[model samples]
Target: MRENTRIDWHARVEQALARVFASLDEPLAWQTLAGELHASPWHFHRCFRQLTGETVKQCLRRLRLERAAFQAAHGEARITDIALEAGFETLEAFLKAFRRAHGISPGGVRKLGAWAGTIAAPSNLHYAPGEPRKHFFIADKGDAHMDVKITTLSPLKLVCYRNFGEYWNLPGTWQKLFELMASQGVAMPAPTGMTVFHDHFDEVPMPDKRSDAAVYVPQDIELVEGLFRYETPGGLYAVKPHFGSCEEIGTTWDKWREEWLPTSGWQLDKTRPSLEWYQGHFDFAPPELHVTLLCDAVCRA
Candidate 1:
């Protein structure tokens, strides 16, 4: 892993705390846990703040509160009992934390009458791909047909590379493509399909493609040295043209999943990972340019 100024002791501490919180049935006191990590309470507290942006107690408290809400929303137990189980001494404290974490009160949760059915509701995984549907953003509906046209595309053959290791500090994979072309004697294009592929649920977002990114390349090009390859199997994509800083492209994803897909006569096709097509200048890439994001949708055959 490339060492950066950002690495600190508290990160390790936070990770340990997360593990402890998840397995809280067999609990350990602060000092005992501190001894296990071989750090003084004062030092651990300081490092926790520096790394997690929250104090140790607050971190544990927050995790407990989240657990309490989860349990209350799922377990067949009283709110007060669930609150105590999560380490909240008072129901009031649990209520406050619950509201903050879920944007709803404990009482509201009970009144909803179906904890198993609600509470951040589990996403449905379908056996087959979703159907294709056209979505458009009109500049002006008042304008004539000349102003707009819609086109459909068949499945695409997407060549890709998986990033691994400490990918954050490294330069964009675009450079890797340049080198790949040099070695293989193939021409490359200004990228039309560039995306960071997150295959699992990890909350903290990082620049390292090792954590994400299953980038696509031209079909004819051979895999270059130091780069691994894959294909985003051809499928229907609920393509959207998102123009923004690359870091902010996630907003488009949120909008798509929450606002659009839910009612758009289409369910997510999980076969191919979503693709991000760059839309702005390639001159000064990384941390500076705007881009487009496409949420790939595998269509029902």
Candidate 2:
């Protein structure tokens, strides 16, 4: 049974990869993925990363670059056109990535005959890829989702209003907490307010949307509300920054859980809570969200 399960899992990983390729333009949502393998999104993310040695998002980025390189080498399209076609919002960003990936400009590739005839495929990028990540997070299957990171954090106390009664009322719950915290001199950093879901969907029937978040503060400070004191333990966490709205943050986790973690030579230890630091002054508008997925080292029993 174990061997059979392994074989099935490998086949599913391939299918997931195929899906990623097929749905490049319009990314599929996590909820929609359940029918693909009869596994929850949480478990599927774990299994896919464990088997394929890369996460879905990491694979997507590579796919985009691969397409860009191919277009540069063969397509009649201009560099800007090729970059836009590959989902890069601007030519500058595309060129920056292209140079890093292939060690030459897209225009330079045409200047050299050597790049011709050779498939413009990406060389395997290991778990700790040479690529730059502004903001990102990785939480794999185990108790804690962190795999690797570099950070300097101080101990903190969080005063949170619990949402134990229902699951979906997360946005409102967060708003209420923020209001209370603001009244108590706890203001959130502007742009995107972060949400970290600790429990998987399967484990908890109605998952809270306002799951948990770190108080955005520049320096160590303490302020408490009545019965809402939550402590944020201080330590180092593997931090991956993403510059996008809150809605797009899941892709960061997908990349880490599926790609970075398995290959990272690190394990998940969820004893410590992860963090999210929003940039700018506190506001409701969707802003860039910086997420930190936390996991601690453990000695096996």
Candidate 3:
């Protein structure tokens, strides 16, 4: 089952790569790619990220930069044209991304032909002119099963408010979300509070890291600007109960990703943001008594 699932995703990803290569010069949305590939946007993004260890955005940016490097090496086009054809909205953005990724500017590449093709990649994938190459990973599935559970999550209509800055420093955000809900006279089905991480913590810039504090409400509840509605798609998720000091939550997550996930018969579903689902009023609960259900999106192997 694991092999078959990976094979299916491998083929689908190759199709996506071909599409991306053909349209390098065009502005493409990750969602659009999912549509063209006949997949749900979330599922497609998740599969691509899991398989390549790169977000769809990251892969696109890398490919554009690689293409730019190729053009510069040939000395066949101006940097402006190269940037535009690479689908970068601005040359400054292109230059910044290129310099950061390759440790050299396009000009530098053209001058010395030092296109760093060895940009670190788990799948070892890079730019190819016509169609990209096939890439997949094979790992032995270990038999160690921890006390984690696989469960189905129903679709959710969430009223969320965005919070930026340090992810862990969000007591005020949750406070605001609940207060706004009260001001709007919204009554939730339960007193559940959820925090959804919109970006990977380590990969995203600290200043731009984003999360949403949300509460589940029925569809009939009206939404205000302070609280917006987001629908979480129904799917399989791996649920692990967390107890004790919230400060140590990071350690638990590390163990899951580094120790359990790689060997589990499930792969991360990238389409959904990781969630911390809280049951009791955390603001009032003692640190030792606080309980959180750490939910990670998952697909069967």
Candidate 4:
């Protein structure tokens, strides 16, 4: 195969994997996926393991368990139904796997309404042809200077563009959103734009990070393709202004989670997502950027 074609295979496999996640109700067969990729089953399996660092069986099992765990915690579905949906033929078999992975029963998780162990959904793995792979962001050692304040915010309704993948790749999503907004005659110098994070990227794998590039808009704006309204929950939040490049903001979040929250006598409100408020037009290429990181907090201690 040509080098470019070989590289393209990685993307093709990633899309196929995403399809598997999206259609968990459908039958999952290696032969079916291999035929779709136009490769023999043995070659497809080898390529998948090389690109994703996990075997096909391992990935499917993890994805199923993670989905089941999420449904148990958030949905009003029966445990047996969830088990069957996750491809388990029997509730006993599902329970055994769930307990082994999470150290708690599905019923126990539902009762607590929270995950008891590290159960994360599989992320889409992308491999560049020749570029060196970059590791996930990590904070520099030491206390980052942060202007932390406690503030209350009213609910905000926004028109948002959603993206799933690495946090660092979010600028592309924003770029697409800007083009859509410009086409609609929306001005560039609007108030600060916001990005709401549904998952903590540092804790979650890169493939699983979910974020929204959003701007506050009136309730009556006409919705277009790829743009939907998101209503943010209003409550008390610990806000901190971060000044630097988008690449460095992860360090700021690490500081807040590790250095500040522990001493502030406040606990994180797990139900709501954290927000990133961008001041002015965010130039993704520039080394300096200004954003405010918002964390939902309550004085529970």
lDDT string for model 4 (1-301, tens) is 4668757766767666766655566777766788888889988877666556466667677767766877787789999999998889999999999876554678876865633223321232222223433321222222334468889878888889999975645667887888888777786535757888887645677678789998886536566799988888978888877754453456457656788778777887767778888766654433233445555444465
User: Which sequence of candidate numbers ranks them by lDDT, best first?
Assistant: 3, 4, 2, 1
lDDT by residue (tens digit), candidate 1, 1-301:
1235235453455455555544544455556656767889776665555444455455555546545555655568888888878777798987787765544677665554433211110111001113221111112111121111122444445544455543321234555655665576654553554654544123424433342333444556666556555544544566765443342345345645665555556665554455555664554563223346455554543
lDDT of 2 by residue, 1-301 (tens): 2668867776776566556666656766544654677888887777666654455666676667656665666657888888876678888899897766554578866554233211111112211123442222222244244344555566655445555533324445676767766775655542334444444233445533235643544444445543244566666555655444332344454555566656565544466545554555434432333233333322222
| Candidate 4 residue pairs in backbone clash | none
Which candidate ranks first by lDDT, i.e. highest? 3
Worst 10-residue lDDT window for candidate 2 reads 118-127
Q: Which ten residues in a row have the lowest lDDT in candidate 4?
A: 120-129
In order of appearance, the predictions have TM-scores of 0.38, 0.39, 0.48, 0.48
Model 1, residue 39: displacement in angstroms? 57
* Candidate 3 residue-wise lDDT at 175: 68
lDDT for each candidate structure:
0.48, 0.52, 0.72, 0.67
lDDT of 3 by residue, 1-301 (tens): 4779988988888778767656666777889989988999999998887776667777777777777777888667999989888777799988897776665678766765533333434454567555536453422232254567989988777889889876544656876887788777875424766888777446678779888988877646667677788877768989877664454465556667778878788988777778888878765764445688888888976
Winner on lDDT between 1 and 3 is 3
